[model samples]
Target: MNRRDFLKLSGLTAASLALTTLRPRALQSPTRKLNFVILLADTMTAANLSLYGYPRRTTPHLERLAGRAIVYHSHYSGGNYTTPGTASLLTGSLPWTHRAINLGGLVRRQLADRNIFHLLGSNYHRVGFAQNLWADLFLRQFRADLDTHIPSPTFIHGQEKPLVSQFFKNDELGAYYALDDFLLSTHHVVNPTAGSASMGYLGLFYGLSNRDIGTADAEHPYGLPSNGYYFFKNSVLYDGICDTILDLHRRENPFFAYFHLMAPHSTYRPTRQFVDTLVEMEFPTKQFHPLGGRTNRRTLLEQRKVYDEYVANVDAEMGRLFDSLDAAGVLEDTYFIITSDHGEFFERGEYGHDTPLLYNPVIHIPLLVFAPGQSQRVDVHTPTSSADVLPTLLSLAGKDVPNGEGRPLPGLGGSEDGARPIFSVEAKQVSSFIPLSRTSISMVKGTKKLIHYRGYEKYPDAFELYDLQTDDEEKRDLYAEDTVTAERMKEELFDHLADAEKTLKK
Candidate 1:
């Protein structure tokens, strides 16, 4: 069985009834206030988008949208996966500080209050929704500050599986860990059963009953796009998002909405129209890493092709969402920010971001800010991190920027600082409470990148350096060849890590 079937069979098919709701009201909004809308597309890496000079025209809609937006060319995620990457965006801190390093982890309790929703204060109406259950955990964590927390399964087909977070709304984070992650665990890498014999038997019958629901249709040749637990149509999802925006517009207050979608993530299910219609090209074959499984190059390329088509399908839906919102005048007074939590990978004998490798394909995500009334496109070539988003949004809301690892993004409330060191961490194996003993840290300053792998049996304390300006593919290892730059960057990286470790003592 595939990942989706396995997850469903792990007893994630429980019935959920209760949902959080808010009263609908109508009043005139403040004339001078600006609404902020963050449209987060999960696993949307810049490595495959045409807007970022990728050979494939997978993101034609984004390319058109970029004409009236601010595009950052070298934006990186805080981590290689959803938990840490999303936590960094919400808290304006790196993985080391927030410590949401594990697969189903949450930020440190002490620093939990320092989130975007809480930082935005009570002035703006906050609405949050996420199809990605891991990303939705953060929304649940910050639900106290949210005026509206849309259910995770909003606007999907009726037969789709409901989230455990929805079932135990009062204790979503705890319930997810207890019921989903522990008792009914089906993550192949993490836990197959974990002694959940009863639930496994129950889920077997449930999966058998719902097996027909996953069959392909004429519209969807492969199958409906799924978030591992449920299937959903992109058209329906975008429609719901548009309707939510319109409803939010009717309210009296300016709003801050974060809609994290799970399209183009995995199960690479593109609509029939998008299948086999994009660019046909080849990527450079690179040396395989011990951490990256031994998936053949042919299989990787085939997976990449399907993934590109899925991305294109999502982009088309985005185009439709933009059109509908623009027609309703929602785009006129809203600062729409488009980005992703982390990225996907189909290289180096790997097919996804599950591997510990922190290469560009898994960490380099797209960042585009469509400011209110923006007419021309502006490009920022300087490298930026996901941590910058929280502080940047606070600045846009006229709030004081908090002291954190991130600064206001350039051209928003701050100027470009080329020397600023941006970092992405991969530490799923590390504990949230202790020091990062096992991690992969990638530091990028200017056009140079240094990747440090620690606590791996295959490669202990290894470092790989590359000048991104000269070798974007990272084929050349400059660590031994360029000792001066390597030593300088190594010192800075270790010093930063040392400082971050001091927090565990407190």
Candidate 2:
């Protein structure tokens, strides 16, 4: 039977057991396996964290936890954007192998026929709670096996809330209400009537009314109430995820919880308290990116201030989560992982992820793995990719991924010894206007790094080599300067690519 079918049957059997009386045998404890919690942040970069030596103390909790965890300092993402990065993480395979680089792309069923979630669901209860829409899309693919999928309700307005159209006297103006108009016009598949989707519609209506649908203020009610404006950085999402996790932890059944947070991503508004902290610290204001054809410097600065405040706010919430888990005495028993899907560029000529640049600021992410009773702080210098996370997690869970592109992380108990060269790929563009014909691939082995560009006529077959030991910032392109080193790195990268291609064919 497929993984989903097996899970359904097992869940039924598990429901009949007396959970309170059940306890995992000593043989099946940490030595054999343990529960897992992967906290994924959206559009987060390690460069901005205090753990990575950033000037700002953006991640005090992560830094404190790093002492007890194995931190992979040189970890990278498999893809430039969220969809591809997350898919690679879940499947433990490259984008080419997974084939889920774009929005509607499906993962290769042959190589990773069953994802980590599916595999866990077969043996354990799997639940996913995501705060972002993109993560919801990813979780939707495993709806049958997923025990629960809770989207962030921070910005949502219940249908019980009055509609904006009710305030308008003119019928035409009332019809102009974006939320009411869209809901009234669109065909509802599950519930044909308007009330069924009222909560969703009201959220959109209020969001549009305040002109803060996609901004930090979306978390606030009516975009008013100074205290409410800081809701984005509040512990709402963290609390929701923690409650779900605690619930699963209390259950006798083993469970896998994927908590994806939307904090420190955008709409950088932090709580008033956090804002006051930033003001006291007098954080430096850096115009990382220019306002492209815009004349809103004052507004933009205010937005950035909010963003900094939110980061600090999230850090505080993270502290709370750690404390709660420790108080529950399950902190060490849980296999905790913390990482981000992708990093935000803050307009440095790039406002978000999916940028053409292959800089560390965009792809380099913070990866921390904490196993139960494991105190060794091993820093893995060998380049690692997000694609390796799934297989690593599976290996920890006493499972196997036969054709996974990623290897189990080293230093972890029961981890294998084979470490392969890591590579990352980004499709140049998705739209015809931006020329979707090119591909950028980055390969790293030891201190040598190479970036290869294919299909761009001007830079076609161009390669850039860098000795990360000397130039970590990647400010200088050594491709033209060091021909011999570039050629060697290029050949090695090509060989790795060829092997990946062969594996895909098989």
Candidate 3:
């Protein structure tokens, strides 16, 4: 660990002991009006952050903030990308249960109402905003629960509505996703989706205006390289989040606010000051596997350099946000949660999170919970999932957690439920509902992880096993070497899938 992180963790460890010794009610009152906020930073990978033992200082702000929060070192997302990952966080169910396994898909209609926003009930005012168009689909799916529903691209790029309206007018239409399938797939339309046409226009606009996806200038501002429907810069998005927090603070009752910010995701546009500083750092070269991945070594290293710069920029912005929350006195009375929808990959012949491969970098995300009156930091090293976030928050809010695959998070009054098995499934290439076809599934129990690939034309069902404790990089595969262990895990994984199918049959 870096000196700064070492000092912070030491201080937190001392504080945690004191807080735990005191009376439980002394921390915060359950009867008092409490607030909840999920600051979802898109694709902020745990593997890259210094807090998780990376040599580079990618998350100094979060590292300091960890002194007063609950940090989960082994947190995994439900899927490799925005759609299923964010859906799992929202609905407290895995991709298989939620059936939002495809890119830019919505939660299954049957499970839509059970979303956290709706389950929190009518007691607190609920608000939602997502800069990523794909994540906004799930929020739109649960629109009935939100008391204040802001436009997905509002307050971004300055004149967000007017600029985006050139392609994304009528915000309430959800960018006409149903119609999008028609236009993007077959150019036929009965009731044409307005947003589909806008997509082409917006793409052209971004192409013309955003010639440099990796440029940040004073004139352009906000590092906004593109004005497309799906992306935003952290510089701009963080400002809007602070403004929204200020607005929500004045409401009569407590509120449950969800802000899923898209930054540190792609294009990797950090400011001029951040670029080229960490360009020479050496990282481990990943060993190739048979599952299939292709990217040049130079390109992967370059992407990692830019991605680290972007993460630094986001860290600075988050520091400003923490100051604002502290000044506004929200820190002492809010259940503030910080996490990511998914993580990015810069190794094993992959740069971004387009996953046919379920490597650690693409699935492991950072999860920090800062409960009100939490004076000392407590770290939870147990493997956890994005799906558990909903149930955990519900338990804190004094609400009955609905019937879902995830239970209450550990280290927060939740005990082990028999032999807990954490699962993450990726099936963007195939049907959302039937994920086993053309898919990759990750099953984690203790330190051992099993990656299963199924229903591929070239590569049929196969498996790769890694003991994370010994092989964090996942360079060595032990599937053939350890038959007994591999077979046991495979049987357990199949049993879990069978249960998910049974639920679908219902």
lDDT winner among the candidates? 1
Q: List per-prediction Cα lDDT, in the order shown.
A: 0.84, 0.62, 0.77
- On residues 88-199, what C-alpha lDDT tens digit does candidate 3 reach at each position? 9999999888889876788888988889999998888999997776787777678788887777757654322222322554454344454443333222242234345666
What TM-scores do the predictions have? Answer: 0.92, 0.74, 0.88
Where's the lowest-lDDT run of ten residues in candidate 1?
Answer: 15-24
RMSD values for the candidates in order, in angstroms, are 10.3, 11.6, 4.6
Task: For residues 246-320, write the lDDT of model 1, one tens digit per residue.
Answer: 999888888999999998889889999999897678799999887778999999999999999999999999888
Which scores greater on TM-score, model 1 or model 2?
1
Model 3 earns a TM-score of: 0.88
Return the candidate ranking by lDDT, descending: 1, 3, 2
Report the C-alpha lDDT of model 2 over 1-506, residue by residue, as the tens digit. Answer: 76644653453343223111122321255544368889887767776677776666677877777666677777888876777778788778777667666643445556444677887655677887655545555665555567665543443322222334333333422332343334442224422455437566655465456544323343442232221112333465567667777888887777788877776676554555565455423323333322122324455445545555666677778778876876786665688888988765543334456455566766788898766654445555557789878877776677765566787665542232213557777773443123225777887766667887777655676677787767676656788888887887787777766776666557
Q: Which runs in model 3 stand beyond 4 Å of their true positions?
A: 1-28, 158-175, 178-227, 230-233, 416-418
